[model samples]
Target: MGTVNTVYWIFTIGLAILLLTAIIVLLFLWKNQGQLREENRKLRMSYDEIEKKYTGVHAEQLRYKLNPHLFRNALNAIQSHAYQSYYALDKLSGVLDYILYDTDGRLVTVKEEIEFARNFIEINRLKTSPLFDIRIKNKINEADPRCHQAVIAPLSFINPIENAFKHADLQSDNAFISVSFSFENDSWFVLQVANKTNDLPPSLNTRGGLGNDIYLDRLSSVYGVEGYSCKESINNGIFITELRIKIS
Candidate 1:
């Protein structure tokens, strides 16, 4: 009877030891899982930060490439036109000064943009009315003014506007550059510019230079291709560029 009691006691002790070991192993696994989850969360956050930085860098690069060219072109035009019989050079200098000094990635009010466009037209008028005729026509729905709200990317018009002045001839009174604005969908806006070019160099369509490729790259970088639309087509000896942007 004493031997049997001892054996039973030993078996009970061993069973308890095994049960404790199992509990300890389970606890270790749970702790490891928690640690893994925390590490994953931290990694995701790091990746997101890196992605944002990269996007900013890319946007800067795009702006950098275009800005220098814009400044140089504006200055050159001023210098070349200074001796000409027109007050446009003085006006151009003022417009360029305002455009270049403005901070990048800043949004200007719609009313401000309208003023810019008007100043732009006056400056062009000095060069010769035919090369670029800029007209701003608006049909505001006062019932819901927000729909006709005006907004534009900083220095956005410099490229296309300059192109109209430089590459296209405004020698003909009929050759007028027109920029019109309209609001739709109660939250979106459209800007359409029709430039009448008497003779567009075939090189304008070529890939490498200041052609569609360069324009497309700049546009994509600024607004993301999904945010804007640009289409170019020649009709009746005029090159028209139409851009539609979402205001919201």
Candidate 2:
């Protein structure tokens, strides 16, 4: 009887030890799995951050790629009109040089931008007839030291001017486009573009056409939420765009 009792006790002790070891193993595996999951989550977050940065860089690269095509088209136009009007060709050449070289920079002086706008206007005038009335009122003198100090994003005013020309009715008797630039309180710079619209192309009438959306995106990237304001209105066959930037 004593021997049988000893054997039974040994068997029971061994079984208990086995069960304890199994439980410890299971706990260790659970802890290791949790750690692995946490590491995986961190890796995913890091990948997302890297993807976002790459996307932004890729988008900026695409935007700059457009510059070469624009330059080519402008040069072709200049070449076509070279012999017809020396004044127009000269203005177009200056504008092209600014766009190709000077405007490779992200920012430009207010004086430079104004000169670019004037050149663009003169080039457009050469394309239109006497029936079209284009008026430009620039209050900021380029010679003023203050004007030279003011700066803006390159090609900031050209988009609206292009849109105006794209939609204006040059054949109508009342066809007109007005462009004006002025300063308010010596702190805010304002650009206004208005045109009589009679026959707008279907493409430009769409929601995202004629590079308007791109212009707005560029503006938002350059100036945050409060730095600039843009207002557009369409009424009675007229289209108007106003841009206000706080330069100070």
Candidate 3:
């Protein structure tokens, strides 16, 4: 063959080989891309299913956490006293009146909860006559009454507050009580009450009156898993107690 024709033939063969290689590479890439797209679709579906399951689980947890007795007591009290207004006794009765009567939902505001706690604390300090310093710092949320609002359990703190006073020592200066409330995240509402007890009285320590048992039972009934819990610690001749829960 002539030299020019031989070179042309070689060059043409090389070009054909290169074109074949490029076509093979393109085909392999297309197949791999299709598989990757399928995998991505499966992953997205799996993620969506997991998200839905988690939502259902969370909603179920909320349902279980919501105690029925808390609102039930408040509603029953109001229903029982629907015929009368006890405002007339406001002056004659002390904190006990608020504790017992206010359960009817007349003063069902958050402020009333603080007022009730204050009265209970005062009566307790008087009853125990704590020689040690007894202090109460209350921060109440004064909500607008014109707006419709939900209800909180009646006498929510009455038993627990009284229990603290009944069982806590009167001689220790660590007898401090504080109550505070705040709104959070535009959804979560919280109320916290804390107190230092003097010491557990014999009655409380021994469970003689079933006072502690009843107290815990009522808390369980009202708060379920969420209601009336205390974190108690002792330090330097002082005892501290804290209680926290979501109100709304």
- What is the C-alpha lDDT profile of model 3 across 15-96, one tens digit per residue? 9999999999999999999999999899668556534432422222222121334334434443454442153123225544
* Candidate 1 lDDT, 1-248, residue by residue in tens: 99999999999999999999999999999999999999989966855553453354343533423445544655555566665525666566656655666435455445455456666766555556334455667555445545323444554554555566665656777777776666777656666666777764434455125544666676667667677787667787777766766564
What RMSD value applies to candidate 1?
17.2
Minimum summed lDDT over a 10-residue window in model 1 is located at 57-66
Candidate 1's TM-score: 0.57
- Of models 2 and 3, which has the larger lDDT? 2
Candidate with top lDDT is 2
- Model 1 scores a C-alpha lDDT of 0.60
Query: Which rank order by lDDT, best down to worst?
Result: 2, 1, 3
Task: Flag clash pairs in model 3.
Answer: 169-198, 169-199
lDDT of each: 0.60, 0.73, 0.49
- Alpha carbon lDDT at 149, candidate 1: 35
Better of 1 and 2 by lDDT: 2
Screening candidate 2 with a backbone cut-off below 3 angstroms (N, C-alpha, C), the clashing residue pairs are none
Clashes of each: 3, 0, 2
Output candidate 3 Cα RMSD. 18.9
The TM-score obtained by model 3 is 0.45
